[model samples]
Target: MGYVKLEIRCPKNVAIVTSADPDPVWTLDDLLSELNSLELQHGARISVSSPPKKSKMKEMANGSNKPFVMRITDDDVYESESEDESTDQRLITGTRFAFPDDYFSESDEFDDEMHEKSTPSRLMQKKSIEEGALFELESDHQLMVKEQLRSKLSSLELSQKIESENSSFAMRRLEKQAEARQELDRRLDKQYQRKIAEILDNHLSILQRNHEQRSQIEERRIRDDATLEEAKRKEKALIDEKLRQEKSKAEAEVRLNAIKQAEAQKAAQEAEIRAAKEAAEKQAARITETAVFDASKKDLTEPKGVENTRTSGNIKQGDFVTKQLGIRVIASKAALEAESNRLAIYDEVAGRINVIDQKVIDKHGRQMYKYIKQIGGTVENVRAKAHVLVQLIKDPMLPLSISLLVFANKVVSLCENPSGSFDKSAFACGWVIVLIASQVPDVMDLVLAEFHRSCIYTVPKHLQASDAASQTKDYWKMLGYREEDGKIESTNEFLNRVESCMKLYAALIQTEIVGVKNPYGLNYGWAWLAMFLNALPANRTTAVALEAFLKMAGFSLLRKYKSQFMKVLNVISRRFLPSLKQRGEAVHDIVMKLEQYLDDKIYLREPEGRQLQASSLSKFFE
Candidate 1:
């Protein structure tokens, strides 16, 4: 077939750079201009054309190529070309070197003395004239033809000898192959027998072990039952003894009460006489002491002997004061101190106090009128004050609901007021308020209304100082992401957050493992880890790690946390399924490893052992 010419029009200015540059500066227009200049300076004689365009460009681009054409150059650019004299004979004529047309002319005479060929084909007839001119005698030409035939026969015999040798070698190879196959069959049969024997032994051992365990469990169960019965009997006996004690105590209490009644009357008379005598003595002492203390206080003399007395007097006063208060005062003081110690405990449970600036709200009223109108309520109508706010939340007004606006001024004021580390009342009140506010679908409409004219508070440097985004991206880097400047550069902060969330999810799953039992718990841990790994984006390193983890924990183990794993899988599979055939094998390989591990542990005593038998036969076919 005549090779079809390929062509492509070069842009007037385009120029392909010979070498790549880090800071190469070139524009589309510049490239077009360069190409046009190059073409004008050096025509077809200098510039080469690109390869041809075909209907299968898409397929070819993937990694396919057509036959090379001489007209096209090495560079991936195009130019048109014309057909040449040399055509592929197999494509055009189905044969090589056809007879020339001039042989059919009658101008050539057939001579008796001319060397003759016996062939009657069209090609022979055309070659007759040339042959007659070369060999004039028929006998001489015949002898030359006979010699050529002998030479060909000799070559044919040599070829037959090589063929015979090849046939014998092939037969020998076939026989050897048959023998090798027989040997393999014999070995396989022996292995199969061994496997069967091992399986039987494992079964027997497992049965024996199970029988022993069952008996031990039965004995323990019986012992537990007997102990439980004994405890119950003892409990009943204790109850009877308590009942008899209560009866005896009741009789004794009645006798003691009757005896106490007579003593009460005698005591009351004695207490009245004592109180009167004490009052007279206290009044006389108070008057005398008040006069003496007043007269002594007037004196400022620091007497040397009185210094020791003063010290002793101070010590005596401390002792007396402590004695008077004793345990009750200490207990009360301790209770108060404990309350202070626990102050921080409550703060954590509470939220910060968000005080609203009514003045700001009033000033921004007109600016926020649109929002208020949207909510079908006026800000002025909403209730204020802590307790009133809580109550209003319990029963919000129709159409208006509840809108709590924390103005920039209010936020600043609250930050300044360090009285409450966190305000419990404010947090509780806020939730209650929001509950009421939810009655209005357009709660934001009314809420933003209060802050319409308020300035957007610049986030405090202290609050915004956390490297949350960077840290999150770094965590993903560990999981595997394209790193930039020694850190993962995710397209958005949101993806980093997702990566961090996956890490948390993995941790939570492992935490949940602490509460699990064998089979069930192990499965749960494995499943959660699988889910976390699965949720990770399709990165080669991450995928490999996931496969390894899964293999250590089987897919069947996911049944341990079926509901949770399935929910995660449902979301992940949508993204993964398109490439599942490639990934599934990886997952399966990991699962097999885990399954084998579990089996080994569960049936250690079995003859076959816990390990899965390697599928050698399947591997051979593969």
Candidate 2:
């Protein structure tokens, strides 16, 4: 709800004034942009009455790169008016004729008696066309007015055609000149590179040949005999190493399997009598207890009543009970407060880790991710790169596990503003987290909590409608509103961020690096999908998040769950899409894409770039 009146000075200083909504003055930029398409010989110059916004105005300015705020003076306005009047008068020489039926003559005999001279009486009779009047001219120009107009129009069209062709010819000549210059530069550079490459190759080959010849001359027979034995020895050592790693991995899996079995049995025992939700809660608690290593560090116990420090003779039972209950109430409140503090600590840690200076990330983060991404593809290369990355960012004071998770935290933080190489290296970051979490399960919990804080749907939780004053702007911030300079982002931009976070989370679940299974794998993904669809209302934002998640994780889920995945898709089509339809154009396109993704069976084809190039892991996802 605002207004913007714009005064534009086109070429020849023709001043045009217009108004626009100022509530969102952003439209002013767009309105100015539209002026570029107008046929102004010199581009339109905008003149604003208000003080200039140096930042935005400079950005919106044309080639001169500053505000071209033309001052509209009386002289310029008067000249523009005179220019328009002259053009009008030149065109007024034409005979203004009306159809015979529409025209009504005031006095038809006046024209017969009238000589070839104009009189006020005759002029008064000829009113405008709207009054059903016609002009009876005394000048000879009326006889050939049609011919004159037709010739003028033809001449104008021919001149315009010639000008257009001349402009195009000039443009083509300039383009050819530029292309020729670029081609010459490219050929010169190519020749220089080729010569340098040839010189280096020849020098390296000569040195290598001479060294081989020397070695062969000194130990020809011995070297040839030992080569096979050396190969066998190295192969044996590699096999033993791989076996040891496999054995340790198997042991960890067995331990996890036993814990899962105990929970499964517990769930089965309570299935008939206990509420399914209660069982689920119990199961989740048990899994968290088993999986979260940091749980031991965060031992926050409620305070309990101590034995009577100084026992008096005899205490009333009711009084003692009342005192204990009050103590418990205070303790419970303290515990809840402590829990909120703990969550804040998690947020603080995540923020701190992700906010590592840009220079540090560029120096170490990308390299760390690169080594982790194609880890086993080339063992020697990965080893060397990972070592370099560790040296670059290593904290000798921290424990190995702590250092690894902290490193992973740094990598995840890059997703917050993926303006650099961080996005290209995201796959590696996902793998880094999964691999770290495989040994230190607290790592996964920390990452999930951070993502949940950023994007609520990763937790598959929706904000419930509430009238409480506490659930104001603070509530939206808690649900991860993106804020910059104390201003919240627009709806579309916020959703874009939500979608990015969802994609990262999806990548986390879809990962299967080396033999370390994704700790929170497709089962968790299945759970998220069910909970999201069941609880979250379908809207444009909902569709955006869901579409992003599916794009990253869908093919894998389809491969693993088959018909079950299809059924969930069916639910989305039947239940989710109709609600999304009412949300506007934003949702409409995504919903159509979602439908096409489902009906076209696009998930049957695995998404490209998802497949990592580990020796055996390459085809595992397929």
Candidate 3:
């Protein structure tokens, strides 16, 4: 029923640019240049956005705080390899980064070597072979030494040699045995050292001397305790004194708080009394003003069938008559005349719109334009204008509800129409209407008062009652309409009209709505308006507006509505998106569908029928 907000966590692949300038113009080349410049510095793996915008750009341009939309295209747009080089390319935001097979060829050997060496299994195999070779050499050397020692044992020699050999052999054996014994002794010594360390670490006797010293210190401390007891008592007294001071401080704070609260209460009471007196006085004044206005109105109404009358003094007869009825109001006539012309054109155009009046349209258009200017709209104005001439139509006094509707509708129509003038007056008028209209929801409760004071008709009682009934109804049957969930059904024809009106509304509101305006006008102006119309059902005219918006959006309202379609798809996606593979497949499917659709509409062979078919297809997705 109000505005819709979407929180999109743009992926790394998409670049966004948001603009606060309201209107901006830049070509595709411009956008590409900016992105290319950015890529040269920030890398291609970024999404640069202009400020958060309500819509997309008609043309690309550098925007102020505006976010520009970008996406990596490496995933798409390629077919086969080239003869000159292997055509492998990565596109970031439409700028191609080519990666040809030839480009990688020079590094192939290096890459292979690096790859092989990096493999854990391969590295381990090489290490094992080296260790095996070293072990084999050592084993061979040990075998040779054993053979030599055997030879030495078998050698025949003189008595001295044999004796010497036996003695040397025995000595060698003795040395070996001694070395073995020495090793055993060393191990035993290490064990003994470990045992000693364990005893030292675990035994309480290790600390006996230190403990005795500590005990002596404790005894001395006990002896000294008596002397310090007096000081301790004094310290306790000081602590008590500090505690007393803190207690007094806390009490004082509590008293201060109480006094402050009392003062605040007294001030509040006095303010309330003053406010009450002022309110009473204001009420009295309002009552007096109402009485005077009523008396004057009554005097005028006493006359039979009075269509319009000029007022004398402070009394004006007609509801449409402003203070100027008595005395000419001072304002710019030229600006007023321009508005008059615009309104005239609006009336003519809306005259044909069966159930709606041009005045309400105008009022709404003006209001929307005002809001646009306030938020920020382009200095340049749109070229289109809504103009219609009502032939064989009677000039009738429109009720306030109908009149307001006409006024609002006309305002919307003018903004939608490109062939219109722009001026400070147009902007100002729109601003005032929107400012006032914003207060309407709040004022709905005070409709009776507004009616009495302003002498405008209230919302039709039957319409209000019917609205209430619809709110409570589980289902209200209307043939030829489809029901989707809790929404009311309406005929396709009716929906189409609503969509059309929505387009008109969007065109008017886009400039004013935050984030939706495109200086070059590429963004869908009517998105918000379409959303608004889809949700609204207060009036048939509103339904017509919604249908208009749908048509403009190139969407069919009869079969699967765009919003509903998106909702259903989104629900399905949520179920499958938890799995990466499934999500990728889904994305692939969507991409394929879009590609096929584009090809069919743009590249099909049909000649004469192409335009019509293409147009129809465009409308389907509009």
Candidate 4:
């Protein structure tokens, strides 16, 4: 038999069996059995076609029938072959097998030949060949199916992998965006914080500056208030002092007027008594003359008879009477003349005292007129006027001196008006008054007292202490001290002038004027010395001059006014020491030397007694 090919279809796989022999035949049952075996081996259900119909088999033998083909049906039987087998043949023939003509032939002879060749050995070989072909076909089909499945699965896996990658990339991009937003927010927050901090710092600095400015303003206000209060106090004090001085002056003037009035009354009474005495003497003389005349007439008429005796007696008596009467008349005349002369002398003396008083009044009026006229006068004019007044005070004529003193007193009174307007002219006038006092020793007490009163009420010039050193040097130079030599050029002359001034002040202090306290409230001598020292430079040379003056004046003052001298020492310690200490070592050393001298002269004599005094003085240095 030629090779035969049979195709069987299953649900999952298609199988084809081929035989090498022509006219190969097998029973339908046997074909079913082989198919079942393939199904079991391949793990699938297979089906075979039934044998062809007799007529159909004859037609196929005649080459007029279709090829045998089969497909598994739901009933486990193959589908019948169709007449249009060209497409099915191409599908089966891809396994490289050809269909036999007698494979589906129904001839009895073909059946017998198949039966004869279908012995066990031949069947076994055929079965083996069929199984091998089927296996080869099945394996080829499986490989093709596997290749298609692998390609489909690979495509699906590639698509899934791409989707997964896209999802992961999207998630990563979102995460990065979130991180970027967070970083941006953090940076913005930091910038906002920095701005806030800067604002706060600027506000704090502004507040600090404002606070400092306010504090400074407050301090300045406090200082201004303090200054105003001090000025008010000083003004009040000056007012009170001025009133007191005016009252004192008024009282002194009243007392002086009272004394003058009493002296005038006494002089008037004395003059009246002299007039009455002179009249009584004149009347007595007249009565005595009349009596003598009557006695002479009676004696002449009495008688011629006893004329001899009477005449002799009467003549003698008349002669005696006449002599007595004449003597009495002469005595009365001489007494009357003496009384007239005495009254004339009294009148002249009273006239001279009146004239002196009038002269003083006139001088005062003139001086007052000059002062009023020179109210705004130049310093030179004031100085000249003061010089004239000084000369007038030095005049040997008592009346001129008294008049100048009265004028001086008036000048002092004018200077003492603290409430009055102060001008340069007024200061110049005051200087003049001080100079007049310095020149006139006799009026030193009155002048110095007036000077003190004026100074007490008057405000000092506004001199800065900063210029004190230069001013002091200039003062020394003016006093004829040589700056290069650091000494007084005319020591003796300087000493003499200083001594004279000290003596004048000393005499003022010593004069015991009743009810008149020293206007400076200290020993006039010491007050003058302090005043001089205050005006001069607090330097060694000034101190030396002060020392000389003190040595000259201090002992006398101490002996006469011990308590006052003690007060002077206190003032010196309190006032001079502090200023001297500020000046330099030269001034300070001079002061120390003076203090040492005082200690040696005064305190050492009775250390126990003067302990408090020494302790008080020592406090200045401490």
Candidate 5:
């Protein structure tokens, strides 16, 4: 007897069947019963195929039986195969069986049974089989079904294990790849951070170096500035010391000269007195001798009583005449001595002034203006020279120099012909006058008078004609009054030049004495103020020319020397009121403006107000 191997296929699993004994061949009934039992256990239907009859069979006597093999395929594939002998032979040799068409229809029931079998109670119930008559009959059937179920379960377990293992391997592979990517990203990020830090450090170092360099430069600049300031301070101290020494030496010399002059004057006075006495004695002797001769002759011829009366009358008349002659002689001698002393003082003062003038010329030379132009016309150098000139002028011990007068004359000349050029020398001269007036105010009158004579009233003779055309033509030909076009300048042009000089002089006076304590009283600028007022109505432009001069002078007087304000105001008001009335609105406006300025600046009490009220100019304000 030969044994057979049978394979049964289902949707989820394949079942293999083999007979336990070789002598018992599996019949159709046995096969059907086994299939039915398998369907019940696994909850799926299965199909079986019959083997073909052979022509001859020889049973070999062997200790082990040879088994026939059978295989199962899908029913859909089996139905598609063509029916032929080769196919039948292949099917028989292959021992394959096809599942029924209802295999999938039973799959749901099969899953239910599998779920039921997984429960522990159902598995225990299935394991406990009872031994009885029915049990004996179904024992073989149950045994076959159990074998087929075991094969199906084993096949399912094998496939599930293979799938689980493959899934675990793929999951592990993906995890490794993710870890590698993370490590690479972390390394790259660290490298980038390090690079950025290096770059930042390099930039910080550069900035620090630049900051240090700038600080050093600033420190050097500060040091240089301090050095320069220290140098300037030392230089200024030296200059001030030198000026003080010079002033002291000059004062000493002046005092000594004054003492000598006084001594000489006293000696001269005594000599004059002695000569007058001797002359009177000689005249008296002559008179006495003549009288004696006459009386001797008269004594021989005339009576004693008559001669005595005649001698007494003659003596009385001669005594009266001699007394008058002696008095006249004394008066003449004193006058001569005074004149001689005056002449000597004048000569000495003139000589001292000439020496100062020579010093000035040597210090500045004719190229002073050239030097002024060289430094871009900045007045710093000019101002320094002006300060020196002012110091010279303010030297009280120095005589009123003719050189000052000469320089002033030259300045006035330049001012009158400015020709649209800045005259630094003229400015310096004006400052000199201001210093002189402030220090030794007695010179103010003289300077003002001279300025009025030489510059203000000294118009060109040709320009003085009554005929306007002739005046204009001659004005063009004059050296100091000509215009750029070779034609006569307008009145305004001429006035402009005069006004500029006046303004310069006014500025000098105003600026130089701003904080000075004027011991000379506020009468300092009175001459200039009076002169300007007197000339106010000389011509149309004269008012304009004097306008700045008047304002500055008035303000200076009102502010600096308020004590003399009323006196100055009275004098100006008296001189200006008549002219203000005649000159119409222009002059009136100018006067009114000045008046308003004064009124605004000055606060007066009843007495002062009353003084102002009494003035004729006060009426215009009213």
Candidate 6:
């Protein structure tokens, strides 16, 4: 960070001569030393001054409190011993600063020849040598240069006749230019006068034509007006005669309409009476049928102590008990939460996240799960549909059984579709689940079930299933593996899918949407981390999920828990890493990632692309 660029100038010319080529990056004294060597090489007095005011950053860059002024005069070079210089020789080359030997190097053969020459001869031929630039000009040298310049300036004089001829040529050229301009202006003026006269003539003729047109139009309009008036008078007389006839016809038609209306009203009244009689008869029949049905139902229902003693031969055993139907007084999760005080705050943390099961649904009937899925929430509205999903899942209007079943299905669906961008689907699901868990702690049980069912380590548990207990494919499937007709997913891809799930889960654990201080946030994240490191054994699956979880939520956990959280990290370093290492190349990449995450302390910064529930909620609200 402590790097600087140098600007060098020559006082004689009062312009920047060269600049730092590589850019100086060292203490101020070292930069000043480089300047000294540069000055000695050029035999110029170099006075260095910094900016008028030093910046705070600049003050921090160096330890030196001394004034920012360092000068290396020509006298300083003569006084300093040669042994003080460093071994490396850097030179200012071209218009740039601080080039190496190759840049400023002269022809090798020429340098050798110069070395062979006597010092006096070298000084005599110094004007041609490149090294002449290295020597500052003394008083004698300045005088010699001025005299040479003056001698070169002295040359032959021009003849008086030649000078006079030149002056005459200049005067004649000026006269010619003036005569041409005057002729061009006269031509332009003549053209302008002709155009003006032409325009005026055209205007006068157009006005005369327009006046004649107006007169003709006026005469025609007057004749048309006289004709129109005569036609209007004739049409008016005819209209009066026709109106008289139409008035007589209308009086007769009105009498006929009135007679027809009276007859129609009589017919409508007769039809209404008939319809009323039919409706009354139908109503009487319906009442009679209902009376008969109620009498039959009373006879059947009120049979005194009558029971079906004879058993049906085709009926299966325990059919009567199994198929019995009655209203179920099923207790809901909200009722249980109230009883258990699952959401009650104790100490500093709230116990909002819980494990949901089929207890409530079992009371209602397991088929409610199927029913809930069928009539489940709609995903029609694509805008923040996840928030709506949370509401639907926890809707009390929906049967508890149906909500739990639908929620479980939704959670399990994410396991397969974790193949896509996590933020859109999988991570968004995590946000929904967190909110539901916070407000409705009963849902946490369902979330845990689905997560643990897919990846056990998400529950912070590792299982080593026996080969005899299940086939290889079945075991992998338990860990959320995908299978086609026969082929199973590759381990790396499986880890990728599982890692996305882990990211979502981990993110949800620590995600705090500002308004709703997540009860299951950093506090839960810390506990999850500590519990996972303490309980889980190291393996490729564990390694992937652990590393992914840390990457997702570690920043928030570290910030929240601080030193206590770091102790858990130390445990990971001391305990978890060795087990991963013993797995050889199977988990080599994961091990490396874990090691890097710890070494670099990547948890110091928030994971990218992970939207906390608070941010997501704000977006939804917007």
For all predicted structures, in order, the TM-scores are: 0.18, 0.40, 0.16, 0.21, 0.34, 0.36
Local error of candidate 4 at residue 520 (angstroms): 23
Q: Write the per-residue lDDT of candidate 2 for residues 1-622, one digit (tens) a residue.
A: 1222222223444343222111112122233243333315345443322222344335646544432233458996687556544543222231122234312344535433332232223222322331121111211123233334454566778889999999999999999999999999999999999999999999999999999998887697778668978998799768766864685475456546644655564355335324422322222211110111100111111112100111121221111111211111111111222223334435444444454555654545555555554433333433344455455433333323334445555555555665443333444456656655665554565567567556766765444222233334444555566667876555656676777778778877887766777778888787667655644456556677898888878899988988888788877777677666644454577889888888887878776547545434545656
Per-residue alpha-carbon lDDT of model 1 for 1-622, expressed as tens digits? 1221212223346553222222223322233344445557556222222212233344556656432222325342222112111322111111112224533344424321111322122212333342343223322333333443444456678779888889989999999999999999999999999999999999999999999999999999998998998899799758755754684465346434533543464356436535634432222211110111100111112121110001111111001111111110111122222222222222211222224345544544333333222221112222223234333322222101212332212322221222331222222222322433443222322222222111110000000101222234333333223466775444333233322322222221222211322221243344334323222223222333343333333343354655654544443344433332233343454344334544454212221111222343455489
Candidate 2 vs. true structure, TM-score: 0.40
Worst 10 residues of 2 by lDDT: 288-297
lDDT of 5: 0.43
Taken over the whole model, the C-alpha lDDT of each candidate is 0.33, 0.52, 0.34, 0.44, 0.43, 0.50
> What TM-score does candidate 1 get on C-alpha atoms?
0.18
Report RMSD for candidate 2. 46.3
- Model 1 is weakest, by summed lDDT over 10 consecutive residues, at 456-465
Over the full model, what C-alpha lDDT does candidate 1 score relative to the true structure? 0.33
- Could you say which candidate leads in TM-score? 2
Q: Which RMSD values do the candidates have, in order?
A: 46.7, 46.3, 55.5, 31.9, 22.8, 44.8
Off by over 4 Å in 3: 1-403, 409-490, 512-622
How does model 3 fare in lDDT? 0.34
Query: Among these predicted structures, which one has the highest lDDT?
Result: 2
Clashes in each model (backbone N, CA, C under 3 Å)?
14, 3, 92, 4, 5, 3
Q: Could you give candidate 6's per-residue lDDT for residues 1-622 as a string of tens digits? A: 1222233333556443343323222333333455566667778635433212234325535754332333458776544324223312333322323434542345655444533441322222323222222222222233333333333333212345566778898889888888888888898988999999999989989998999899899989988997899899789758755764584365346434544554575456446645644432221111110111100011111112211111111211111111112111111112222212211211001111133344643433333333322321222222244455555654444444346545664565555555444544444455556655656555665555556556655655433332222334554555566787887776667777678768767866766654555555676566556545533446677788889888888888778777877877777787678756765565689999999999998989766545433333445688
| Tens digits of lDDT, candidate 5, 543-602 | 444554554445555566566556655654454444444544434655665556446644
Off by over 4 Å in 1: 1-266, 269-622
Pick the winner on lDDT between candidates 5 and 6.
6
Which run of 10 residues does model 4 get worst, by summed lDDT? Answer: 456-465
Q: Which residues of candidate 5, in runs, are more than 4 Å off?
A: 1-158, 169-177, 180-484, 492-508, 512-527, 530-538, 579-622
Candidate 1 lDDT for residue 150: 49
